[model samples]
Target chain A: MNKRILFAVIITVILCGLAQAKTTITWWQFWTDPNIKPVIEKMVTEFEQANPDIDIQLTDLTWANGHEKIVIAFGSKTGPDIVELGSDWIAEFAANNLLMDMSTQVASDSADYEGWGMATYDGKVFARPWILGTRVLFANRDLLTQAGYKENFIPLTFEQLNEATKKIQALSPSIYGWGSNAPEKHRLYKKFLPFFWSHGAKLFSDDGSMCLLASDSSIKALKVYKELHDSCGFVADQRGIEDAFLEGKIGFIISGDWLLKRIELENRKINLLSSFIPGTKLLGKSFQGGEFLAVNTASKHPREAMRFIQFITSPENQVKFCVANRSANPSSLEAQKDDYFSSSIHLQTFIRQIKFANHPPVDPDWVYIEQAIEEAVENALFRSGLVAHSLYEARKKIEKIKAQ
Target chain B: MKWSKAGALALALPWLLTFGIFWLFPIIYSFIIGFTDQQLLAADTQWVGFDNYRALLSDPDFLKSLKNTFIFVLGTIPLTTVIALGMALLIDKQFPGRGLFRSGFFLPSITSMVVIALIFTNLYQRGGYIALLSEMIGLSPPEHGFLYSGETALFSIMAMDVWMAVGYYMLIFLAGLKSIPRELYESAEINGAGKIRQFFSITLPLLKPVALFILVVNSIKSFQVFVEIFVMTKGKFETSTMVYFIYETGLTTKFEFGYASAAAYVLFVIIGVFALAQFLLFRRKQVAW
Candidate 1:
């Protein structure tokens, strides 16, 4: 009887040890929407259940302060095991050695993801593209009809867009024809980049060693943007523009797919349609922006973090999360072909637009470059500077940055 | 006695340690960092000496921000001081529902600045209440909203700041008024001095220290104006203040910590100079008194 008791006690001790040995992976993400938070929580729960030996701890961050918080955390060497970063932010983090290189893990299938380029630096992948957020042209169909355009008409070129905006502006003195964002740093550049891309303007040379901001195509793009602004008499930030469009005060706006999801959720009454951004030669090309998932360099449970990333970014799970959010497109190619995407014509346009989307250069100095572009745009649009002169000055500044 | 002194130090050790660790250490470290090329996320920082400061001297954006900050400070301080003093004098008198008036004036001071800024943002938007009122009064408002226009954005924010800040300063003035001996006013009245003469002779002269205090404090606050511009204009439309520029450089733009620190030190020096000048001026006046 004494021997039996001893064995039972030993067995209990081993079981408790196993339970206590569970690896906890802490993940910090910035999707704080009520609708999306639950989906993430559910996924975490599911992940924990499937891998019972791994405990997933989740922390939500607000978009406004999330990047700063992450920087502080990493700078203080107290970051979580995993983090969700904006695609634009990955370069800075990876350059600082704050992120773990996941190149080996993602190498087998990185091409299958839409925004993996943003997560790569020095030929090493540091993060996984979790979502592909691309903006398309959103038109108030009623306003378009009022402007004498045929029902379901979408502008295919800058000229067509300008003509439609002129007609729309004539419809009512209060109604604006085009909704353009203000020339704010970090924001205005993204709005204007799509125009450059559509005009076949190269921001950098083939080797990425030189800036081409003053190229003829680039100047042409700026002229077109200025023309649109002057014609439409619309000047506001993206949020203001969206609000105006929702209120039927604007006829045309270029915005993210999330706006469509918001309109649906709000059950807004306006007749709205989505199309690729108007292009000069090609169909509307846009700047590809998205979120990425990365493991912190300081994480002790790197393997567990990697497992979590893999689980969350699997094609099926990607579809599940994107369908739940209804705001972002899936990064996974297979997921993009899922029923949820195929069933909606609006979402289909976004998928097609994503094919032509290009990301900003993956340089750690991208923030400075973005500021330079914004300043140039602001000078051209608001200040008393010629577009060519502004672009030239911006190019010189960008060249200095690149040289550094 | 030495034992007692040691005991007192022991009792204060927690606060001393906290101050040293959280405040003094960061201030010193940041001063050191200001001499380096310390991007927040960069793995390596280089000691660049005075390069950041030298660069700032030639930076057009920094110069513009400095100018805007000065404008904000100059525009808001005297207005806030005078208005607050007036309000304090009015409410200091014996009257019905004086307490109610005090609370009403103090309400905005205690309210969250973020909420107030958001409300003001809407009011300054195109076709919002303020724009509508301006049009109704036959004044031509900016077509794209006050906040959107470079000419009107900073001034609009300045007006809001003055409105938001005057109430708090008024409370300070009220405190100063309460401390004054009623006998002086009564004696002046007995001398056949009118109310204006009593105010100019007794009230203004007696409130010198308090007025100086308000001026110094309000100037410091105005110089550091950030949240209003952040929430409303996002530092666009030429409304960026020095503090906003520091914040954007340090956190938002490129995480150029060293550059931001240099800018911050410049602002700190400016504020320190102003404070010293105010102190000297107040001391000279006190001597005259």
Candidate 2:
């Protein structure tokens, strides 16, 4: 009886000591919407349950002020162990050495994920890709049918799409053909660069020392865009354009998966059809954007933080998260092949388009470089026969930025 | 009652601490940052002396923003002041539903600027209400609507600013009108002055101080135009103001803290000069009167 009691007391003491050794890691994430926050919470709970020695403290951030908050947190050296960063933001932080070098950690598993190019700096991976998304063309079937086209006809080429849009627009004075982007910063380039890429234009030289925006292919792309803008396109910011498309006043709009989910949830009466972005010969390439997870350099528990990231970014967990997000897709190829995407035609179209999508150049200066590209597009759109001049000016500006 | 030095310092401690921490600290720190190449996330900050200031003088974007801010200040202040004066004059007299008119006119002023700007954004969209009205009136609106065109974007924002700001300034003018001792107007009437003559001589002279206040305050506010542009256009279509430029530089696109701080200091000096000029001009006018 004495030996048994002593054994029981030792077991209790060891359990208590193990409980006291639990490590708590703080994670700041941007999935705060009612429908999505629960998925994250559930994942964290599962992670904690599976690894009883580590606890996660989750903080919610809004899209509007999240960037500012992250910057301030890092500035004060109080950054969370794990933080979610937009794809475009990873380069800037990595360039500043604010993120931990994760190339060795993720080397063996890097081939399993997409969007590694965006998270890499100096050929080193700094963040892990989480969710990936691409854009597709949303067409109004009724508008096409009303304009004497077949009910389910899809435009596989730019010329055909433009012609059909013009005819649809001619049906009524209130109707518009293509929903083009206005000169809104951070948005117009996203709409224009696909065409630039479709025409085989490279944004920068192979050495990354010079901008190639003034190339013949780029000029041709701009000319094509201007022709579309003048023929039947209506200009507005992204929100206005989406609204018009939903209201049945626009024939076609190139938008992301969010619009597909929006139409499915809110207004199902509209006969919507999705298709790939039309190219000259083949389908045009779309822009790839995504969210990534990074470990802060100042983190006290880098191992726990990376383990949590890997746990949350596993194929099953990613598929679950994207299913709840309703618009985004998993960055893992295995998750992309899941039954959910294969079953839904609209989601399938986005998945297929991701195969042909291209990410922007991975550079620390891309933020300023994108602004220059946006200004060039806007300048070209505002004036006729100035596409070349605008591109030339943009090249000069980018060179100046690089010099600075 | 007499108080000890310790008691006095204790009473002033809270406000002094707040001022030192929030206002004075940032002002001085930003001033120092303006002289160096201080990037937000970069570890190394080097003193560049007057390079930032020199670059601002030649930067086309800064020059464009300066010009736009000036145009905004010049275009809106006079119009807002005159319209507020007119509305105040009309409502100062006993009229039906005077209280209702006052509240209705002041509603936009009290409403959140972001909400107002968003409402205006939809109103300014293509085929929106404003476009429909333009079409109905047999006028050709810009093909892309008001906010999309470079020629009309700033003007559209300025028009909205005037509409929202008129009510507040009108309230101030009403207070000034009320404080003018009505007997002065009666005396002018007794001297055979008509209503318009009395307004030009007695009311205008008495309201000079209020007018000066409105002009200075409106100039400062207009020069720092950012929220409307940020919400409605995001500094596109030539609508970027000085503050907006600084914000985009330091916070949004690039974290060029040094350049943005330099731009902000220039704006501060410009505002100071303008306010001083206004004070001097009003003093001269007051002496002449």
Cα-based TM-score, every candidate = 0.93, 0.95
lDDT, candidate 2, at A371: 92
* Alpha-carbon lDDT of model 2: 0.89
What would the per-residue lDDT of candidate 1 be over residues A100-212, giving only the tens digit for each residue?
A: 99989888887787787888898899999888888888888998887778895888888898898889999988999989888765679888999999999998999887789
DockQ of each: 0.60, 0.63
lDDT of 2 at A45: 97
Model 1, which residues run further than 4 Å from truth?
A: A1-20, B1-3, B92-100, B177-198, B287-289
TM-score leader: 2
Predictions in order: lDDT: 0.89, 0.89
For each predicted model, how many residue pairs clash, with residues at least 3 apart or on different chains? Answer: 0, 0
Off by over 4 Å in 2: A1-19, A383-385, B287-289
| Alpha carbon deviation, residue B207, candidate 1 (Å) | 2.1
lDDT of 2 by residue, B161-263 (tens): 9999999999999999898887777788888999999889888888999999999999999988999999988888888889999998888765789989999
Query: What are the per-residue Cα lDDT tens digits for candidate 1 across B1-289?
Result: 4568889999999999999999999899889999999986777899999999999999888999999999999999999999999999999999999999999998999999999999999999888899999999999998778997788999999999989988899999999889888898899999999999999998998899899999998988888998898889889889989999999899876678999999999999999999999898888767223
State the lDDT at B27 in candidate 1: 95
- For A246-321, candidate 2 gives per-residue lDDT tens digits of 9999999999988876776776567889998888888898888888999999898999899999999999999898
Chain B TM-score against the true chain B, candidate 2 = 0.97
- First chain of model 2: TM-score? 0.93
